[model samples]
Target: MKAFNIEDTAMILIDHQVGTNTWASTTPLELLQRNVIILAKFAKGTGMPTVLTSSQETNVNVQGPLMPELQEILPEEFAARIKRQGVVNAWDDENFANACRNTGKKNFVMAGVTTDVCMVAPAISALEEGFNVKVVCDACGSTNQIAEEMSWRRMERAGIGLTSTNAIVAELVKNWASTAGAIAFPLLT
Candidate 1:
């Protein structure tokens, strides 16, 4: 895909809740949290439109708010957190889909907890809908190595871009002299 243009790109963060993280094992919890915050900070610093969502909010088994680390960096007014009545695939939720639709952006940079379900489901959905999707692998977690690898393979086969936090940030920054680059460059390093 081409370079990420801030105007036409939005960050979609799904199901990165405290309850969900308890079973996440594909990536180290600490590192996953850190990478997520890194991406959140980049989006916050760049004034990118970010959409946050959770799964089965009303279900007692998996109930929690967005990860505190990410919530801290994203200002309430700037980050639009969609309340889905417990939709597993964010793309299935009207609010989440509308949020992305409202952004008027075709390119979506997304990451979420549980790579196979939370991450891959919507990534493929968005791709099928003709939206350009990029999955931040390191920032996404799964139940285990097999699930994570399988999810990556599934998304890759569908033509979605799989990348790392640093790579995505670098692609977005593009140049050090521009306004966004100047501001985001320091955050990445």
Candidate 2:
């Protein structure tokens, strides 16, 4: 797959809710949160279309708000783009899927709370639907190490690209000589 072009890429954040994050033992919740913020800032600074979703908040048993750090980075106006889905796989929700499609971007960068379920499902679904998908592993987590590893393997075999938060930020910035780099370099480090 080609490198992410800022113009053609949309960042999709799924199930980064407090309740979902509390169950992640594969990666430190603090680190996962920080990476997520970095990605959000990258999208905001570069004007990349972004979609944020929280699953089953109203259902009894599943409940939580999006991480505060992630919410802070999003402008109040963009709140309309943040969808609350009833399904584990966000692509199953027409509102969430349409928000992404409306961006007119073919390349997608995804990061979510649960590596195996929330993250993997949408990444693969997007790929199957003809959207180029890149998973930001550092910004994602799983219930355990085994599930996380197995999910990554499955994603790789399905031809979905895996990348780090820093890589995605840097690739979008392009270079230190460019205007975006001048702003991004300080934030990335």
Best prediction by lDDT: 1
Clashing residue pairs in candidate 2, if any?
Answer: none
Worst 10 residues of 2 by lDDT: 76-85
In model 2, the runs with Cα more than 4 Å from the true position are: 59-62
Candidate 1 error regions (>4 Å)? 58-63, 77-79
lDDT of 1: 0.83
Tens digits of per-residue lDDT, candidate 2, 18-96, equal 7888777787988888788888887888888888888776553555777777657885524665556567788888888
For each candidate in the order shown, give its overall lDDT on alpha carbons: 0.83, 0.83
How many pairs collide in each candidate, listed in order? 0, 0
CA shift of 74, model 2, Å: 1.0
